[model samples]
Target: MLERIREGSQGPLAMTIVGLIIISFAVTGVGSYLGSSTSEAAAVVNGEDITVQEVEVAYQNQRARMEQQFGEQIASAFANETYLANFKSQVLEQLISEKLVEQKANEMGLRVSDEQIKEAIFDIDAFKIAGQFDNDTFKAILQRQGFTAVSFRDYMRQQMTTEQLSTALTASSFSLEDEVAEVLKLQQQKRDAQTLEVNAADFAGDIELSDEEINDYYQANLSNFDTQEEVKLAYVSLSVEDLMANESVTEEEARQNYQDNIAAYQTIEERRVSHILIEFGDDEAAAESKAEAVLAMVNEADADFATIAAAESADIVSAEEGGDLDYIVKGDWSESFEEAVFGLEKVGDTTGLVKTEFGFHIIKLTDLKPQVTTPFEEVQEELTALLLKDKATDTFFSLQEEIASAAFESPDSLEEVSNISGRPIIQTAFFSSGNYPASVNYPQVENVAFSSELIDDKVNSDILQVNDEKILVVRVAEHKPQRTLALEEVKASITTQLSAEKTQQAALDWTEALKQKLLNGESVYDTLAAKSLEWNEVSGIERFASSLPSEMTKSIFSLAPAAGQDVDVVSLANGNVGLVKLTAVEAVDEIKAEDIEATLQGLANNNSRQSYDSFVAALVDEATIERITR
Candidate 1:
């Protein structure tokens, strides 16, 4: 498995980092670690250090992936600590596996050639189109990832080498026909089962509790029983929405800005062309000679482009469509082929043999359209609205800071800030301590508003930063202390609690009774039905358990049911009781006659690898690893 590390602030890139970290184990040899100091490394395995720089790169890659998947959501909570820690651990495991694979490959003398690296790099789907590598497209992707041409090539080479090693390791390890047949047998197996539920509510009438006992329980758990303190406050918030409603931008400014950046408004002419590619033979002289002869045949004939394409073109899809490629804008095709096609004027015109990375192509212009630009009057309103929104955002934040500063120094209530600033004070009604009040739009603001210091002491909260610029300060208007309930007030609650306890014990007793009936050779299904419960059969369940609607599947799987034997009553995770009867036994099949030799060899290789991994892990465990956290 490959190891990866995650890093970055909340964004698309951050999410990508988190996902890549999760899947890093599959890649092998790469690991991620988090460290703040330059000298500190996240982890070291077998004397190979996982550096901070490597972690950062992996993190960025993960973030980019997240951005692509979730768009705006990637920016919200990508930097959450729980997420980052999990990502780090996963990436670290992957890195360790990658290093182990690399070490094994080296020991086995496995190496990648220059030609192999070149082919792998050129063949990447992100860098290619229509069977050819596009340099501009390749460069653009690398630029977005902050990688240079040389660095990308190196990265590709390492990936190719690692993949070659993994293929060698897993090539021989595969299930034999007999093994598959046995697995299939298990898949086809079925089971008959029954379940009984002991409802706790059924025994509620039998339980009894004294008033003194109930009072003591309530007092011991006062925090749970007492009413939570709640409050209402009034405040005004300055937001871009408020300012944008009143702000306006002049048409003259919009027009001038558009004219000043005229290049952004200009449109470029575009065309679409498609051609058949016949790759040259390995013999240089023969291939060139064949290409030239084919070019001459098409030129000499007065045949239509579609006729020539159908008869000679190697690209089956486009050739069938008479080389129809549909319309393309700028940066869509190879520079040489695009330049030639765009240079043509009249319809039915064709170019001479054009050689690109894919092969030689005989191009014919399909369609062409002249560039068009929108007039200033048509776009002025849109531009002015956008400009005014930007201006409002700036002005709103400036006013927010001034208001917050004044409120902090005066030591007054929320009303004082609202009154002095002439902004209306908003109030939230009494709310449970942990629950958010209905009036607040920002949960973080509400959280601070109800904090112990702000509520009980009646002090202004620390400036709360929302997004990049918006700030808020909150002060409590009223405080209510939590109090314990009297025994008379909580008697009904104690009665309900005692009743629930009794019902739970009764359910357990009922399940045990059903188990006894099964042991005495009575039909479990009949007993379950008699007790007002239901019996179900879940067939073809795999040994690797998953969710099941019937409680019997959970009970049966947990007991490791043996053929013709009954399991005693089992309680489920959610407090349901069940019993299971084993109807069949299945075991993995041994190697078959045809696959015996191959399967044995594969098992030997896997055993060898497992031994090697265990040895390495032991060595790593013995080494001292000191960490200094920042």
Candidate 2:
């Protein structure tokens, strides 16, 4: 029963266990296992034991995730001996880290209060409505996730506590204003640069290869020349789409169904209304006086509503339309406005001053539409088409299973099955392992085609159920094996690569020579121009860092700007080299007041988190962790 309950929901078991542990800790001032006896201590940090049952629960929860994502076949492979070893190592590391962090949190006396937990929960958007916390919504969400209110709140509380612990440990790591200014300057800077690309084609014509060498290379790689075994497949798919196309429903039935469930399709009566809004300033007396003046003019007819709206209405959007608002359905407008609009009995009828969340408004109803029920006769054709399609789909899949069974037993051809089932058999040309044909998007069809048995020998697959109304059967007519390329077929390509390598070496040597000349008191621009190489400069380059392109920005910024000193050469992963020198350094622009406040808050949060992480790391280092794997 418990297994069934757990399986019915997609929520992770680890989260549930963590929530339970937190609740236990909160209630008893120490953690204890509540679910089962499998909870034995797994590790210890400064006499604080990490339970074995807790680790197992976490592991199972993670394994379930792997199973859900990759399916049973791949999940089994991942759970095997080799993969399990790696998984164990990762699990142990995480456990150790958590223990270390917890121990540090204890040493620092970091704690979370009930009031803080309640505040955090209320602040979470998921539990709020209309800018306020809604207990019903929170309970509904917990129920949907198979969690009790207590369990859900415990989970939230634990997360908040963990955050608190982190903040305590890392609060001191934040930098001063000068450091932040320097960082900001680097972030906002930009570089204007140009590159001189030396093409491989420039050296391609200079390289030559001998026939003898080519022949020797081909002889050493004969397997590369062998043709891969390619396969053609013959298969049949059945889907409800064909059945649905053929089925039909009568007019009488359509009308009856519509009458029986009129509320399901009936739209609410709505009105197209518009209004002239008069917004009040912060001063209550002034706002009231303005409202009274606008109301008196509207009531006296001295000024027409549309003309007055155009001249003085604060809601410019509706005022420009002569206070014309489009048709609005129930719940579309604010409560007071909606009530006033719906209360009108005739078009062009104006309402008394109405107050809503937006402001004061004098509304005029322009148009009205009464709710109407659609007649069954009017929708008969649609109903008929839907019924026909559903019938055709049922017939299609019913015939599919019979055809698949016959084809699988015969092992000779799909012709017999096609004739018996009266369904057309389609054929595919040679396809590679990773290639997915447009028709193979159906999971059942693709799975059958990729099966080892079907690929190895010409065999028909069993009827595969894709959905309730769809089934497929496939047979392999050909097989293909991947092969390498022979040297003779690729010799020209190799020669081109070799030539490009030599050209790159020559360019590097030239660059080096220019560097030495600069070091010997020669102007970099003059030395480069002497060799017909042009020099370019990039200014205000940002101090960006990334591993991609092999840290080009870092290398560029690392260069010194001392006069007569050659910039250190930096190599790129793409076989390019560059030399850079800093031109100038400047502080960041003045920070805005709001921006300064935001920065301070962000810095404080980051510092807290860092401290917490360091504390955790320390605890993990001092702890004894053991793993008993099955």
In the range 1-630, model 2's lDDT, one tens digit per residue, is 223322322233333433444443333212222234446666654665656766655566566666777775555445244557678567766766765665554455555557655655565566679989999987776555556656656555545445444433343456677666655655665543322222333434555656775666567767756665456778777677744544666667667766776786676897888788877657655755676777777778555778878876889998998777889988877888888999999997888878876678888888899897766667667766765675686677577657766877787677777776556889887876456576754545554666678877767788766666666677887766666665656888655545566656655665666567766767767655554556555555566634223344665555544655325455555655555444554445765556655676788777767676566666656666665444
Tens-digit lDDT track of model 1 for 1-630: 222211111224433332343224213322222222364466665566666566655666666666767974454345444556677666666555656655655555555566655655565555678878988986776665556666555554455454444443343245556565554545444444443445555556666767776777777777777777776654565556667877777777888888987766667776766665556657656655666776777678675777767767777888898777777766777898788787788656778878777677887777777787878887777788878888988877667766777777765666656654446766666566566564453545655666777776677765555555345556677766677767778779887775565566667787777767766777767756665767555455555446453455655555546533555565555544455555444554443454555555666677657765665565456544432233
Which lDDT value does model 1 have at 250? Answer: 78
Error in Å for residue 249 of model 1: 5.6
The candidate that wins on lDDT is 2
Q: Given candidate 1, what's the lDDT at residue 569? A: 65
Residue 523, model 2: Cα distance from true site in angstroms:
8.3
Q: After superposing candidate 2 on the true structure, give the runs of residues whose Cα lies further than 4 Å from its correct spot.
A: 1-163, 167-173, 186-235, 248-372, 410-438, 441-450, 463-471, 482-484, 521-556, 564-630
Lowest lDDT sum, 10 consecutive residues, model 2, at 26-35
* Candidate 1 Cα errors over 4 Å, as ranges: 1-48, 78-110, 134-173, 176-184, 191-200, 209-236, 248-384, 411-465, 468-471, 474-495, 514-549, 553-628
Clashes of 2: 28
Provide the lDDT at 305 for model 2. 75
lDDT of each: 0.60, 0.62
